[model samples]
Target: MQNLQSFASAMSRRLLREAGNLPALSGNDFASSKEIQRPLDVLSQGSGSFSAFPKSNEQITTPSLPESAENVNAANQLSAPVTQSADKESSGSKYSNWIFVLIFPAAILLILVPILVCRKRGNASMGPWRTGLSGQLQKAFVTGVPKLNRPELEAACEDFSNILNTFPTCTVFKGTLSSGVEICVVSTSISSIKDWPRSAETLFRKKIDTLSRVNHKNFVNLIGYCIENQPFMRMMVFEYAPNGTLSDHLHVKVYEHLDWAARMRIIMGMAYCLQYMHHELDPPVAVNDMRSDAIFLTDDYAAKIADVGVWKELADKAKATKEDGSSRSVSPPDLAGNVFCFGALLIEIISGKLPETNDPDCICIWAEEHLKAKSYSTLVDTSLQDHQADELEAICEVIQGCTDPDPMQRPQMRDVTSKLKAILAITPEGAGPRLSPLWWAELELLSMKSN
Candidate 1:
């Protein structure tokens, strides 16, 4: 009985030892499963996070477990690790896709917005621009037409001259005639008239009447005349020229004041006026005495032709005598002679010298001699020494063409206008010669000449 009791006690001790070993092994297996699952979670985070783990650590050992519980636990642990890793990877992918979707469209819009704005601005800036003669003339006329009286006419002329002093432009003032009748007045400084014949007075009135019907920037506006019964006392009020006359200003000293630009402008203005008279008018007005003295200056220094009526009267008187079979006065030449005189004027403009007098030996003859020799430099105004050689040559050629000895060979006023306008079109703005103080000085000079 004593042996049986001792054996039972030994068996009890062995069972307790076995149970203790089983618990230790189960704990080790649980720790091993956790380590394995942790590795899977680390890989699922992202490449950056996974790289942070220590690669040098040794792997831990796991103890064996009972068959049924170990198999079930292992399967669950493995499945949970894989499922968690997949979920983490899908979430990372969704975040990356969301960032891409938000950034790409914003980048495209940033690039395209400035291009659209630039295009819109470009279209807005390119609106209409105006540069036409008819439009400018109409504007000038409208502004000047309303104020036409004796005092208002003089004021207009003075105002026009003042305006020209500020900028290059022309203006006209009309004088009150019969009640509401207003006649145009253009002012300029030209050669003085020593005597006013009865024929001249009649012609002046007739020409004024004719000119009143026309409107142009280049033609003289015949406002009204002040008739004095005494000789050299009559005053014909027209537009005032702030810049004076071409004749007085064309000399070397005076010419320097008129830059090449201003001179060209004067030529262009005169040519256009003549063109209007010869071609544009209904019964083509003939400028029988076209001398530089007859060409007036506007406030802007543009040429406004004067003395249209004086020659018309002379022509009419000559015609009347020829019809009546009476002895004619020592008359001037006909229309052909007028063209010849105009040619002389053109030569004077280029050479900056007075036309040859009735004396056969004149400046025109001298210029003609030099012109035939192709010594064009001698023909140009010495004040224009710095101007373009090519331009000077072209102008000389035109002058020579206009001043041809034969009237038939000379270019008509229309052709003259066209050529001058072409030259102006090509010339750079402000490229002409500077205006001279001599232009203004001429007012005193005219007063002196009158005395």
Candidate 2:
């Protein structure tokens, strides 16, 4: 019984040893298996749950889902940062684009308004004088007397009185002043007259009387005068020159048909008139307004000095004088300076061109330069080409003398008139008609007299 019991104990101890060896083998198999980590397993077991190993072909062949999941998570983390950066860059670009669209057109409108307003105001101020033909006719009709004869002057005064009764608007008259006698009349409206201050009116009337007494053929004939008691108006009576102003013949675009003989006659007459005013008339009248428009022409083409009384009148008005007296407003040297203005007038008459303030080639300056260069041929009016060369040269010389810039160098009006007469006396009579091409071609069909 003791031997059998010892055998059972030995068997039990072998079984126990075998069981321990099998458990160690299973542990080795487990260690050889491919390792993979799950996110949850990692969190539960900590970083120590994963083991580092050299990969064999068998381990590489195993499904790598857990490793793929780890790679996918890493890739997603990196892509998220890239997308966030891209979104910020896109947002920054959009904001920059939005700011540029708002600021460019507002700057242009603020700069153009004032320039338009000034131009509008300037145009408006010139409206009265620049009004059309009807307005100009109204102004002319209301300002001066129409041409009349001595018998007609008498009839006109009677008619004027009758007209005044019918039209009270016609209150002023343009008529003759005969040795302090005021008679003969052509009437104008009191309201139609341009406003002149009371001081100006009294002064002008006195000077007009002085001018009216001067008797010369070339001087405008003032027969009589009167001033009615209206606030800003005055009237004068004078012999009217029927042929209109010298400027009409000199520069009229459609009606400029003065022949060479007529022009020469007119120029001579003008020279004589200027001479008489400057040398013969007592107190040496200075023609301050020497424009061609102030020169009147008779039916015989004789030049009569109109508005000779205007300068003295203006001077008196400026001085606030009322008494009828001859006052020398301009000095002798200044009166001589009027010769320069006369030269400009001559240029306007000779050439049909007006003096422009802007042109460097103004008529007087051009003529003087040409004269200095001995190119007198250039001074002849292009329309006067048919005129005798010697006569033209003489006229040019006279014009140059009159227009001299230095007042001291200008010839006296008496000398100018004497020279003009000599030239006229020598000029052949009845020269063939020389006409302005601009007027001649159009008016050829009409049988009007060349003069």
Candidate 2 colliding pairs, count = 10
For each candidate, the alpha-carbon lDDT, in order, equals 0.49, 0.50
- Worst window of 10 by summed lDDT in candidate 1: 127-136
Give the top-scoring candidate (TM-score). 2
Total clashing pairs for each candidate:
19, 10
lDDT of 1 by residue, 1-451 (tens): 3554575466546554554443333345556764564322112222321211223364323334435575557656875766577667667855766677778789999989997886555333211101111111121121211112334434434433432221111133433322333334443221134333444445545554454434455655533343334222233444344445676677535443667766677666666656666666555566655667567665566676775445435445534644664434434324445445555665677667665564322666777777788887777776565565676666667767766777788777677656766656533223222342222222322332234
Off by over 4 Å in 1: 1-204, 225-236, 252-256, 308-338, 356-361, 426-451
Q: Candidate 2: TM-score?
A: 0.48
TM-score of each: 0.45, 0.48
Best by lDDT: 2
Q: Candidate 2: where is the Cα deviation over 4 Å?
A: 1-198, 230-232, 308-334, 357-361, 426-451
